[model samples]
Target chain A: MRAPIQRYRNILDFALSSLLRRKGRNLALICVYTLVIFVIASLIFFVQALKREARELLIQAPDMVVQRMVAGRHDPIPTIQAEAIRAIRGVEAVQPRLWGYYYDPVFGGNLTVMAASDQELAVDSVWVGRGVARSMRVNEGDLISLRGYGGQPILFAVQKILPEASELVSSDLVLMSEKDVRALFNFPEGLATDLAVTAGNPRELATIAAKIVELFPDTRPIMKTEILRTYEAIFDWRGGLMVVVLGSAILAFIIFAWDKATGLSAEERKEIGILKSIGWESSDVLLLKFWEGAVVSLTAFLSGVLLAYVHVFFFSASLFEHALKGWSVLFPRYRLVPALDAYQLTVLFFLTVLPYTAATLVPIWRAATVDPDAAMRS
Target chain B: MASSPMRKSTLCLSLIGVQAALFLVMLLHANAQKDRAIHQRLSSGILVRRLGLTDLCLFTEARYTRHPAMADRHAAFQDHPMGLDHFPSGSLLAPPTFPSPHARTHPAVPEHP
Candidate 1:
């Protein structure tokens, strides 16, 4: 074992020296490989961060959601449901919510608005995202009049403005008082658009959800954890796309590797012949090739990771808006708050980098199996 | 033992053909997947409409308005001058007309079937 390790070390040293001598070609290969990996990694980072950002915003916002369904339309649930939801076993609090657009017939487009059922409870207050506040040009205590459904003029006094939470999903919320919500549109009592529920044990969430459904068959219980499930589905779809891209990258790398290893130049053939003539085994040649592949692939992966960080956190993941944002009219231009913990890095390394590097071994193994004299003659 | 460049060219062409075939397969799969996605979206939209799920966001109601003049006119038209021989050409409820091309020259009479 010691002898093999020492021999491998010698091979690696030789490979490193050879690469150093041919810096221009080696560097070009490294750059191309790095770029391909970099784009893939950046996409991954942006996608994960986007999901996290949305979930984080949602986490603080609701535990369970209740929306009214009448004739398949989501009408505001009567305020009475808020009282009934408070009696559920795991529920800690129930907040009735209202959301609508305030159109100014004089102005062309609608202004987004949201409100709560009770002002003092702060249950349905304007959750002003950073972007909405900036765009609406209004502050807390400013009275804004908006045209409701069918041109009914509704006015809301901004009681509070929500501080910016997550740029992913928080940039679009507006909260208001229940009285203001009713006065705005004159929707009757016992009606709410949705009820936000907070349960005690996060583990018993499913049981609690079942209970709620049993109690109110008409309401849809939107659990907060369901976002994670949705993201998993989304990620699975993305993973399929990545499999194709990464698979192609690996195939190309393999072809290049096989061509380089099998079709040796005259100088290389002469050198190998001389080495074999001087008692170097075929295994030694294989080791050298393996080391070369390792060096190139590792260098590419490391550089790609670093470049992905810059692309996501520093440049704000600009290359990935279409997939992550879908067709949202307003997208917040914000840098990803990357969670660069050891676990994430370890996962990424194993998941993306290792698969590509391992693909190089098939060609290396083929080259290694060749008879030295036959290889040299070829 | 030098292999002819033509032989090498043929090998390269074969590899290219293999890669092209693989890529074509991937493209077709992707397109099929995309078509499925569009189909799903359309079906989901229809489901939402059928279920009235979209009604939450976009329900609008239309109510009929009661106007006394229109009601009176309709009632009078339906009654058909039963006790009287001729229909009144002018009524107090009719808006005063200045000289106009649209005004009736005489009272309208009901035609017997």
Candidate 2:
């Protein structure tokens, strides 16, 4: 056991020295490999982090939302219907929700206006999101006006700006009192934008929804799980699209690696010849080659993944943020929580490092088995 | 600068070992950080639910984007079913499985009768 261990150690030393001798070539290969890994790893981390954040936030959402349709368009739901929905056996309670959008002419962006049932704001006062605060150039005590649905302007005082921690979901939000919301939108007294439905047991949500639709044929009941599933699908699509776009780069790297593996340089062949002449066995030659490939592949993989982590969690993956994250004017600039999926890392290993390592062995085997005199003469 | 093969091999092996250890440390640090963030974020997320915020405001550009859950699926089809979507974000979403009301194919009264 000691004799074999000593033999392999000597082979690894030869591998290391040979690698250092051709530093320029090996360095170039590592650089290309690192870049490819960096781009792919960065994409995976960003997409996963976004999915996590969305999932976490969705836990707060209502189990079901019912929307009223008029002539195939969304219309203000009659608040009177909440009692009818509550009459459904499975539904615990149905809360009439009032929310709408306001397009800001000054900032050329849209603001989400919502009314909270437990709001503490005084009449004619509103709380704004950090994005709204930054874009509209307003802070607490500032007054902003919007044209009502009746073509008249309504002025509202900024009560408070929401905290930075909630910015991811609240960036374009404006929270107002129920009375203020109805007034600003010139909303009808007996109507709400939609109905928020909660069920006693989540498993019964589907049954509760079908009953609601039976009661009101013109309404659509959207489950919270449906929305969450849609978000998951959208992010995965976006990430998959990025990977497809990067497919060409990955292919080029593979081709470069294949070329390097199949065609050993003339000097390398001579060096192998010299090793065999110096009483090195064929297995020793193969061991040296394996070590050489392992060193380059492991070094590149580690550097790339490390850089990707910092790029995503620390710097917010500014490199590809615009593509993966949806486009918006008041886009929230938030750092992603550091997270790593071991399964994804393993998949990345199979895609990148394994192929190159395997490719090196076959071509090196052929060279190792050749007679030393013939290998040197060539 | 000729070092013993044993020393050279030891140095090379140690270099790879250090990188491997660093990579493991990074993964553990990420997991620890994630746990910390989850606790902090759960508190903030409660505010979102309390306010009845449905859709995440990923893009504040259009009404359809700001609250896609309540979006009017037929908005593009206002003119006709095959009308093209004008919003960029609209195209990214899969055709929503909106429980849109459909005309009854089996009539309450038989057409033949």
Candidate 3:
């Protein structure tokens, strides 16, 4: 064991010296390698962070959302449907949700107006999201007038501004009392935009959904699990799309790696020849080359991933932020929660480092096995 | 001459150390931020919607089926027909007809055959 360890150390020393000898070429190679990994790693981190955020927030979503459909369009659900759904077995609670979008021409964006649950706001008061308050330039106690469904301007004093951290889901949200929502939207009484249902047993969610559909055919039931799956698929597709867009660059890098591996320069050939002639076995030569490849690839991987971490979590992934996050004049600037999956990291390692290392093996073996005299002559 | 190799080795070692330290610090910071973000989100009552990159594809594919205006408005809703027979007599009260906020020029209720 001691002998093998010593031998491996010697090979690594030689590999390091050889790498240093070609400082200019190796430095350039490392730079390109690191850049490629940085881009890929940043993309992975950004997408995974977004997915994690979605999953965490989705846990709080109602177990099932029931909406009424009429003539192939979502229509307001009758509040009585909530009573019928509450009677369904396995249902723990049912709440009629009053919510709709109010297009604010001033901001050129839609503000989500929802009735505050369990809180009664004064008829003339409203709670606004941080984004809404900033765009509207309204502070607490300031009244902002918005057009109701009747096209009449209604004014409400700002009660509170939601915290900035919660902007991921509530960037354009406005919360008012049920009375205000009905009066503002001219929404009829005894009707709700939708019904949010909670199941007593998570395992009974599917059963409850089916029962709701049976009771109300026009009702559409959206389960929390379904919403999660939709989000996962959506993110996965976007990530896949990015990979496809970067596919050419990745392929170019791979070709460059392959060329460098298989096409040994005259100086490298002479070095191999000298090692083989000096009683160095083919295996030793192979190990020496392996160490060189390992050092370069491992360094590149670490540097790239580290840079990606800073770019995404610290810098908010500025490069891809506009492309991934939707375009909004009043885009809410929120920090992404940094989360790393061990599985994703492992996948990246295999995809980026392993292939290059493996590619070097064939050429290294071929060069190592050559007759020492013939290699020197060439 | 001998000192040159020593200098090179020291430089390489320091580079590796610096990179490793940077990685460790960033990773620790990320984990801490992740925990705080998760705690904040769980306590805050907010529903997940198409907001970020997911929206790019979701909005393009006509796949915003989860939107309030489009939820269950597709073929899935047509698959399960709930005849009037399913409703218990007097269980569902007739809601007063009111103009829908979105129904501008069209009739509030489409005429059913």
Question: In every candidate, what fraction of the native interface contacts is reproduced?
Answer: 0.00, 0.59, 0.22
**Rounded to one decimal, what is candidate 1's iRMSD?**
21.9
Cα error of candidate 3 at position A87, Å: 2.1
Docking class of 1: incorrect
By TM-score, how accurate is candidate 3? Answer: 0.81
Two-chain complex of model 3, DockQ on C-alpha atoms against the true structure: 0.12
Q: How far in Å is the alpha carbon of A103 misplaced in model 3?
A: 2.2
* Candidate 2 chain B: 10-residue stretch with minimal lDDT: B104-113
| Chain A: TM-score in each model | 0.73, 0.93, 0.91
Specify the CAPRI tier of model 2.
acceptable
Residues A187-299, model 3: lDDT tens digits: 99999988888889989999888888888888788887887786787677667777887999988988887898768898888888999999999998888888778878888
Model 2 scores a TM of 0.86
Backbone clashes for every candidate come to 24, 0, 0
The lowest-lDDT stretch of 10 consecutive residues in candidate 1 chain A is: A103-112
True-structure RMSD for candidate 1:
19.9
Using TM-score as the measure, name the better of candidate 2 and candidate 3.
2
Top candidate by TM-score: 2
For residues A102-211, write the lDDT of model 1, one tens digit per residue.
Answer: 42223222234555333353532354545455555678767555554444445555565543333333344455565656666676766656676777877767877787
Q: Which window of ten consecutive residues has the lowest lDDT sum in model 2 chain A?
A: A322-331
